[model samples]
Target: MALVETATFECGGCGTCAPSTWIDYDRLLYPVCPEYGRATGPLA
Candidate 1:
């Protein structure tokens, strides 16, 4: 299984992190990059 890591963000008190597209929530949900998902090695 992929060992997922968390991302930190600079938010505008909004429910999102721009560019990275990571959501701002009371509890976080990680958004994997499309390229990262396509990678088929250790993280696959």
Candidate 2:
């Protein structure tokens, strides 16, 4: 089984400053922010 880990960060885009979650896997970083509304891309 593979291990999973997560981290929280602050979003400094869109002037909202919402909180974001990041998952760490295989040395890769995946960020999730509410400002992006479930999109996998960066905030506009």
Candidate 3:
């Protein structure tokens, strides 16, 4: 069997979805994280 790769992106400014950790196997990268500025939730 063969393997396939794909990339996905999302906006962090508006917390429409839950945050996620990023992983890059090809290149070395510093620990990257998303910054949620404004969000609407039950706690808000």
Candidate 4:
């Protein structure tokens, strides 16, 4: 048997409206997380 995963992303271009904060991650850059509802998780 085989397995697959599905993910979705939505950008509202709310950079100006987005909150201003400092977040540290493994990567130098961070990913954009929209305010609106979205699905994100691991599937098996």
User: Model 4, poorest ten-residue lDDT window?
Assistant: 16-25
- Misplaced by over 4 Å in model 4 are 1-5, 14-29, 32-44
Tens-digit lDDT track for model 1 on 1-44? 99976665434333333354443222234343343232222322
Off by over 4 Å in 1: 18-44
Q: Please write out the lDDT profile of model 3 over residues 1-44, one tens digit for every residue.
A: 88955554344434333333342222233322244443322333
> What residue pairs clash in candidate 2, if any at all?
none
Per-prediction TM-score: 0.19, 0.23, 0.23, 0.20
- Report the alpha-carbon TM-score of model 3 versus the true structure: 0.23
Worst 10 residues of 2 by lDDT: 19-28
Tell me the whole-model lDDT of each prediction, alpha carbons only: 0.37, 0.41, 0.35, 0.34
Sequence-dependent TM-score of model 4: 0.20
Against the hidden true structure, what lDDT does model 2 obtain? Answer: 0.41
**Residue 10 CA error for candidate 3 (Å)?**
2.2
Ranking by lDDT: 2, 1, 3, 4
Candidate 1 lDDT trough over 10 residues, lowest sum: 35-44
lDDT tens per residue, model 2, 1-44: 99975545554444434324342222223344456533233332
lDDT of 4 by residue, 1-44 (tens): 88864443333343323332422222334434445323222310
